[model samples]
Target: MAKYVAPAISLSPFTCPACGAYAQQIWAHAIYVQPHANTNYDVAPLRRCKCASCQAYSFWSKETEAQIFPRAVASPMPHPDLPENCAAVYLEARNVVGDSSKAAAALLRLCVQHLLVHLGGKGKNLDDDIAKLVKEGLAVQVKDALDICRVVGNNAVHPGEINLDDDPAMAGQLFELINFIVRETIERQKRLAEMVDRLPQGARDAIAKRDAKALNGLA
Candidate 1:
């Protein structure tokens, strides 16, 4: 028998960012459980939910219930702290490197830039890494984006054998690596944003203003 258990409790209630209303229907009360019936067919936990605002009813099985469905958190609206200009800069640099696929390279660049900005006051000089990241605009860091100008990006462009067309798979692999970097970096920025929000308004304004010393918490 598959031993499965529902979460200890329903997730915390959150106001929907979209509709700006309490998402009461998200509190899942019914969880499907397998009966001690024939072991042949797997009995999964199930859930039924009704949206009070939308009047929509949905059914879910045990397997799907475990997945963080009806995500607990709502995405925040765009804030002023982010560097809006960097998006265009990322795109222009990617164009230099022939980033033609779905061409999300720029967004990946933005993701890394924000990650580094969040880490600005912290970590080693990392300025060389930052310079390279800003210049190259690629996710060279397997662990962190600072590894980019530190290694991959410039090295990949080294003048040895220009066989980019011969093996297009390399491009795909690079894109995939960048995609991972972008995904992780974006998540980090979200958490950091909340942290920044908790600080006093003066501190928040300093960081939002991109006051390097202020962001570093020096002042």
Candidate 2:
């Protein structure tokens, strides 16, 4: 997975926001001059940068040094342990966030639903599924994160209290929340199971027996 880093300087090596490749960005400034009736007009100067690794081009304003092309936004890469289906939707959301935050929020909401389903949710209503997971001892922080996505996503799709049209930052936050959910639920549990499996067989059996006795009120 690609780690996102903000480009600091024009000619320095930084992660390519377009393809997430870390490479040297070659920078050049160009100002187009248009002449009419013995008069020359200079257009706004733009700094062009090309990534050495991916050969992708990005434009920046010469004066402000702000990214122009590709509409720079800080979005995290999908978690390594995220399910393939959820990751696909997450990427889709990231792709359109710069254009339409409402659409991105809606896609993230869909990703959240898919993630819950992968975690044994019933594949029905999202609210009901979240409630069930909370009842099943989902972490308080995880539940809260899920609810934030759920509410924002809901508002994105339907006419709701929150307006997502002007809030790309909030939409960006949903990406991190989705990854956090995957880490808390899937990755943590998988790591715990792997640790348990690495224990000696005798120790594993002893733990099973202890758990059984505890369930049976004999511990």
Candidate 3:
């Protein structure tokens, strides 16, 4: 029996997909040192990594330079208002976006539905849910864009609802639209909270007074 040690795995360049963090730790190694005529590399090593930010585990193969299994990372979202299930679904969608556009699109559509439900919007289907968001004050332009996502997602899941090209670019657009909506709602609230927290005592009192008066219908 012989003891084997792999060189420290580089956490640079490759980002942890789950947490959007650059830091990682390797806990195990599998290395193959056989000479091969098919490949140029002399050694093949597979390293197990745990992201420092999210503590999620992934295995990295040196030859492929990629996480071989669970190929998708759970990258952090900008919006605190996004539900946990939606975030997880978004990550899964992102992971498959490069390989399967239809699957990603369907998951992204589900993400939108989860977000709408989390935000107190309800409907029998994704289209109705999106309409509920518009009724709740979502901008018309955003609603129009979301409707496109709804249709695309429906096409992906049901097939032939619409003639879809099934391209990665279209999947990317759905992902981006969901992110935009989350940031617009969740991050905006966080920023506003931060601003209120930084206000001067006198300003805070004045704002509170105004709010109280408004609530009492006296303002």
Candidate 4:
């Protein structure tokens, strides 16, 4: 049995798994310290927190000085390179991967869709969407990799298609592919923007002039 405890003086803000919102005003509605006869660090409290943004509740447990462990949201933080829509769907897929592989795969497919849209790709389906990326200057290898993910997700969601088993290894592979795409696409743009920001004003103006001339076919 565990004993209830008053929450510590300072409660740090954490992201909520339910709504994918960063919540600062998390109130510990209930907290219980687990019974531990061995270690001093076993003083970690189990807590239920309510998010102000979405008004959704989440659970937290297992604290370390270096790391804060909240329920499903802890293992993998949403990628900074992912767009908001893709990140939300990616997190949803992660949350349910253990219970339903098919559902998770469907959510992952949506993530791919969001990514494609972010890249200004168009298609009637995911395959065409991937092909559009290739036409728009994405590397062939990356497009091929994304195609495989799309195939798996498509099979998982189809009515008569064979169901994908809840395989952790397979899920991990899909996530790895998604992470790579995000880095290659969004992160590259971020780096370029940062580099542009650091350029000298004269160099920036010169580039702008060159671009304008090219646009006007006067270069």
- Winner by TM-score: 2
**Model 1: which ten-residue window has the lowest total lDDT?**
1-10
Candidate 3, residues 1-219: lDDT per residue as tens digits? 011122234553245555554554545565444576444432337777666667877777777666676654332332345668888888788777777788888988888888777666773587777766777788776687778788888888886655445355776678667767766776677789999999999999999999998999963
Q: Rank the models by lDDT, top first.
A: 2, 3, 4, 1
Candidate 2: deviation at residue 49, Å? 6.2
Per-residue lDDT of model 2, residues 29-82, tens digit only: 644555555554444567778889889888888788788786876687788789
TM-scores for all candidates: the values are 0.29, 0.75, 0.64, 0.63
Error of 1 at 208 (Å): 20
Worst-scoring 10-residue span by lDDT in model 4? 1-10
Over 101-133, each residue of candidate 4 has an lDDT whose tens digit, in order, gives 777778888888878888877624777777777
lDDT of each: 0.43, 0.84, 0.67, 0.66
Tens-digit lDDT track of model 1 for 108-135: 3444444465534222344544654456
Best candidate, lDDT-wise? 2
Least accurate 10 contiguous residues by lDDT in model 2: 35-44
User: How accurate locally is residue 46 in candidate 3, as Cα lDDT from 0 to 100?
Assistant: 71
Stretches > 4 Å off in candidate 3? 1-14, 23-81, 161-166, 215-219
Candidate RMSDs in order:
13.7, 5.6, 8.5, 9.4
Cα TM-score of candidate 1 = 0.29
The better candidate by lDDT, 1 or 2, is 2
